[model samples]
Target: MRKKKVLLVLLLISQFIVLAQDYKFGKVSKEELKEKFYPLDSTADAAYLYKSRRTYYDYVQNMGFQLVTEIHERVKIYTKEGFDMATKAIVYYTPESGEDERVNSIKGYTFNLVGNKIQKEKLSQKSVFREQLNRFRTSKKITMPKIKEGSVIEIKYKLISPYIQSINDFHFQHHIPVKKLEAQVEIPEYFVFNKKTIGYYNVKLIKESKGGRIGDTQYGVNVFKFDEDNIPALKNDEPFVSNISNYRAGMKFELTQMNFISIGGDFKTFSSSWSNVSKQIYKSSSFGGELSKSGYYKDDLEKILTENTTETDKLLAVFQFIKGKVKWNEYYGIYSDKGVRKAYKDRVGNVADINLMLTSMLRSAGLNANPVLVSTRNNGVPVFPTIDGFNYVISMVELTNRGYVLLDATEPYSTPNILPKRTLNWNGRKITKEGNSSWVKLTSSKPAAEDNNLMVTISKDLLVTGLFRTKYFNLSGLTYRKNHNHLTEESVINSLEEKNNLEIEEFKLINENLIGKPVIRNVKFSSDNLVESINGKIYLEPMLFLTQHTNPFKLAGRKFPVDFTTPWKVKNMVSIKIPKGYKVEKLPESIAVGLPENLGVFKFKVKESGGKINTICVLQFNNAIIAPQYYNALKDFYGQIVKKQSEKIVLVKQ
Candidate 1:
C-alpha cells in the first residue's frame, strides 16, 4: 500500500512537470530541437511536441450562435522524411449555397539551433495556398519556412463558421507520435449532440456542466476536456483497409436535437434513428423525387424490355439499357445532379442519376426495386444515423420467389449481383417506396477468381519462352475491365512487357466487352530473367512472374481488420518442358496449409511426368473480412505462401 501511494505521487509530479513546460505559439524551447528521436516511438520520423484545440459556440446580438475553433500545434522533425511534416493541409466544407467556414489569424514559426542559439523563421504568405477539393470541400495548405532535420515548428490558426451543426471531427492521434495532447469542446444548453468514437485507442475526456452569459443571456454549458501525454502514432497504411480514417482514434459529433430556449422554448430533433434518417432522405426531392420521374427514358426502356419474357430477363435488359443510355460523369453523390430526366437527356450523370433511373425502370416493369444508399470504399462506412451517411446509390431488385440482386448502372460492365469494387465497402441502406429502410450488405456474394495456365519451354541458351493464358471472373473480371479497358492493345502489351521484362510475340484479350463472362488474356513471351543458371544447373521459381515475392501483410501487430474486399481464389497450372539434356534434380515439396475456421487454404503440388514438370497451386479465401484477432495468423499464412512460391525448381545436365 505504501509503494502504491509513492508511485501515484511520482506520476502526479511528472504530469505537473509536463504541464509546466512552455507551449506558447512562438515560445519554442531548445529542448524540443535538441531531441533526436521520439522516446515512445523511435521509428517515428517526426512527432507532435504539443497540440491544443478548443471549440465553442459564440453568440451575436441577433445573428445567433456561430462555431469557433482554435488550433495550435508544435512539431519536431528528426529526419529528412519528417520535413514533409512542415506542410499542413486543413480541409473545410464549402457548400455552394450555405455559409462556409473561414480560416483566420494563421501564424507559424520554425525554430532551429545554430551556434548554441535559437534561430526562428516566420511563415511566408507566399507559401500559403488554397485549392478546392470538390464541389463542397476546400483545403488550405500551408508550408512552414526553414524546415529541416532537427527543427521545431509551431502553427496557430482559428476557424469560424456559421454552421453550428457542422462541428469538425477531432482526432487525438495522428500518423506521427504525439508527446502532449489537449482538446476541449463546449456546447450551449440549447443544443444537444451525441458523440461517437472510433479506433482502438481511447482517451477519457472529463465532462462538466456549468453556466455562462452571452450578452445578457444566461445559458447552461457543457464542456468536455482531454489532456494526455505520450500517445503513440497509429500506422495508417495497413494492407487491404477500406479506409484507414475509419479506424483512426477520433470523435465525431452529430446533432441529435436542438432547442431555442429563449424563443418560446421551441425544439427540433435531428435524425434520432436510422429509420428516421432514411425517411428524411427518401422524401427529399433529390433522391426519391428523381426515382419517380421516368418519362424521359420510358420509351427507350420499353423498347429494350419488350422482347424479354422472364422477370430476370427484363431486369437485365433494363440495367444494360440504362448503362448504355447514361454514362457516369466521374462524380459520386447520393442526390441527383439535376434529375434522372435531365441525366437521361444529356447521356451522362452522377451515380444517383444513373442508378436511380435504373430503379425507376425496374419498378415500372412491375419488378420490386429500391435504391440502396452507399458510402463507397473511399468514403468510409456510415456507422451513425445521419443524412450524410451515404455518397453513392445503387439499384436492388427482389423477385417474387428469389433472393434480391444488386445492380449499379454507373459501371458499364456491372452485372446483377456482381457490383463494381468501388461500392463493395460494408453495408448500404436500402429504402423502399413505403418509407421503410433496411441495411443490406454491399460486398459481393460471389468470389473474385483468377485462373492461370502456363506452358513453358526452356532453351539451351537459358531463355524462357512460353504461352501464358489467364482468365478473370466476377470481381476479378470487373477489376480487369476497369483497369485495362481504356488502354489500347499496344499500350497494354507494352505495359505487360515492361512490368515482366519480357518480349511479347502476340497478345490477345478476349471477352472484354462481354459483361458477365470471364475476361481472358493470353500472351506469348520470352524472357531470360525468369531463370538463373548457377554453374551448370538451372533454377527458376514455380510461378515465374506470377510469384508473390513479398508479403503484403508486414505489420507486427494490427488493430484493424484485414479486409480482402471479397472472398477470392487463385488457381495456377504450369507445365514446364525441360531442355533436351537436362534432368530434374530437385523439386519443392508439396504442402497444404489452412487458416483457422476455414478462412483460407493454400495447396501447392508439383510432379514430374514424361520429362515434363507439372505444378498446380490453388489458393482460396472464404471470407472477405478477418477480425483483428486473426491478424497474426493471417500474416503467418501469407508469409508461408510467399516462402513456398519463391522456392526454386532445380535442374542439371545429366
Candidate 2:
C-alpha cells in the first residue's frame, strides 16, 4: 500500500510538469476585450481591439531537441466615420526549429508619438518568466464639451508588447483634424534574443477620406534603427565558418500625414517568427538536382540555330525571345520546391530561377555564360562570399570577339547593351561549374554619351525662332529610351514645349533602331516678346533662353569621389540678324573657363560680322564620379560657366 501511494504521487508530479512546460498564445474576442477595457472617451471617433497568444514547446528533429512556436493574432478597427481606413498587417512563423527548445526570449519596445504626447495609465500584467510587460495608458482626461478651431489638442496612447517582438499599433478615439495637423509612426521590426531570427509584418490603411492620396498620408511602419553591436557576430565553430547572431527578422509599418487630415486607428500583428533558417535549406534542395528535369530546353539546338544566321543575331534573337516569352512575377525568395525547368516551362519564376535558366541555356548553346550574384542597392551591400547575403541574380555572357553583356530579364525596358542601375553596386560573384565563385566588376569604364545643341535667331520685333537638338548615348541614351517607351509622342512633345514656354511647330526623334545607342531629339519652335525693351534699347539673352550655365558640383569640401559616368557636352549658337536700323551697341567680352587640372572646360565667344552678331558657347564635363577633395575646384568651374551663360548683349536701334 505504501509503494502504490508513492507511485501515485510521482504521476501527479509528472502531470504538473507537463502542464507547466506547455506555452500558448490566445486571442480574446472583440466583445470580451471591449468589456474588459472600456474607453474613457465615449465621444471618441475610433476604437480598436487586438489580442495575441504565443506558445512554445520542445520537439525532437534531425539533431536534437529544438524550440517550436505557434503564435496567433487578431485585430479589429472601429470608426464612427465609416470603414475607410486602410489597414495592412501580416505575421510569419518559422517552419523549422533548431537545436534549442526555447529559441527566443521576449525583449522591449521603443515608442514615439507625433501631434500629441503619451502617458502610461497602468503597468502590464507579469508573465511566468518574470518578464515585465510595460503598459502605457493615457493620463490626460478631456472635460471640454466642444473643441474650438485653432486650439491645440493633445493626443495620447498606452503601448504594451513583448520587448523582443516588434509592435506597431495606434489607437485613438478622435478624428484627426486634416486642416492644420499631421502625424507619423515609425517602428523597428526586430528584437534581440540569443540567436538571430527573421521577422515580418503587414500594414493596412483602414479609414481614409475620399479622394485623398493614400500613400501621402500613410507610410511604412518598419523603420530600421542602426546599431553597431546589433550586427550578427561571426562565430568560428567550424574552420572558416562564421555565423552572424545580431539579426532582426520582421516586416515594418509606416504612416504619413495627409493634407489637413486626422487619423485614429490601431495596428496589430497577425503572425510572427523567431528565426530564418530557410535560406540554407532551400539552396541545398533546389539546385542539387535541377539539371535532370525534362523539357528544360524550349527547343533542340538545331532548330534554334536554323532561326539565326550570325552569332550576334542569334544572341539578340534568343534574348528577345526569352524576354517576350517569360513573364516576370516579381517574387523574390531563396527557396521554392519548383525546379528551374518547371518554372521555365510554366513561363514564370523569381530572379534566381529565371537568371539561372538563362545561364544554363547559354551554356547548353556552347557560350560562356555565368550566373552572377549581386545585392541590389535597396538590399544593402554584399558581405563577400558569405553566400547568404545576396538577394538578386543577373547573368553575364562572354563573346569571343566582343567583351561581355550583362542581362536582367526582369527589367522590361532594359535593352541588350544597357544594364539596370540597381546592379551598379560595388561588385558581384560569378558562380562557376565547380561551385567556386569569383569577384566580378560592377562598374563600367565606358562613359555615357551626351550631346546638346541649340540654334536661335531673333527678329527686329523681338520674335525668337529656336531649334534644339539633343543626342544621348550609353547610359544617357538608355535613360531616354526607357522613359520614351513609356509615354506617347504627343505627350513628349507637349512636355518639351511646356518646359521652354514656347509654341512648338515641329518635333522629331531618331535613332530608335540601335538598342542602347545614342538617342536624338530635334525640336523647333517660335516665340514672340522674347527680348525686353528698356530705355529705348533691346536686351536679349545671347543664347535665347537656353540654360548656358549649370552648377555640376555643389559639395563645399571634396573628400568624396566624383561621378562622371554620365558626362555632359553642350554647344550653343545664336545669330541675330540686325534690324534695318539696329546694330550691335555692346558685346560681352569672350571668356574661356575650365578646372585647373582639366577636369572640365567651358568657353564663350562673341563676334560681329556681315550685319549679324553670332554668339557661341561650349561646355564639357568628362568625369562620371568626382571626389569631395576636388569639389571646390569643380564648383568654381561651374560658377564661371554659369556667369558666362547668363551674360547679355546690348543692341542699339537707330
Query: Could you say which candidate leads in TM-score?
Result: 1
Residues 1-654 of candidate 2: C-alpha lDDT, one tens digit per residue: 999999987885454233212112231222322321113323323222221222221223443212233322122222424122222112222233221112233321111122353211221223112211111111212121112221111122222222223223221112311111112222312111111213211122222211212334432233222111111112222211111111122222221212222334334322221111122222465542453232557574457767775767666666665666566676544332256866777987776666666666666666777767776645544322233356677778888989887777766656664666666655776665555556677655555556666666777667888787888776667668777867888998888777777888998888854664568888888888567778878787677657545575554543334544344566666676666777788888899887755667788898888887888777776654454566777778778877776777788777
**How accurate locally, in lDDT, is each candidate?**
0.88, 0.49
- What tens-digit string does per-residue lDDT give for candidate 1 at 459-519? 9998899999999999999999999999999999999999888899989999999987999
Top-scoring candidate (lDDT): 1
State the lDDT at 328 in candidate 2.
Answer: 66
Worst 10 residues of 2 by lDDT: 238-247
The local lDDT score (0 to 100) that residue 44 gets in candidate 2 is 27
| 335: Cα error in model 1, Å | 1.8
Clashes of 2: 73
Q: List the residue pairs that clash in candidate 1.
A: none
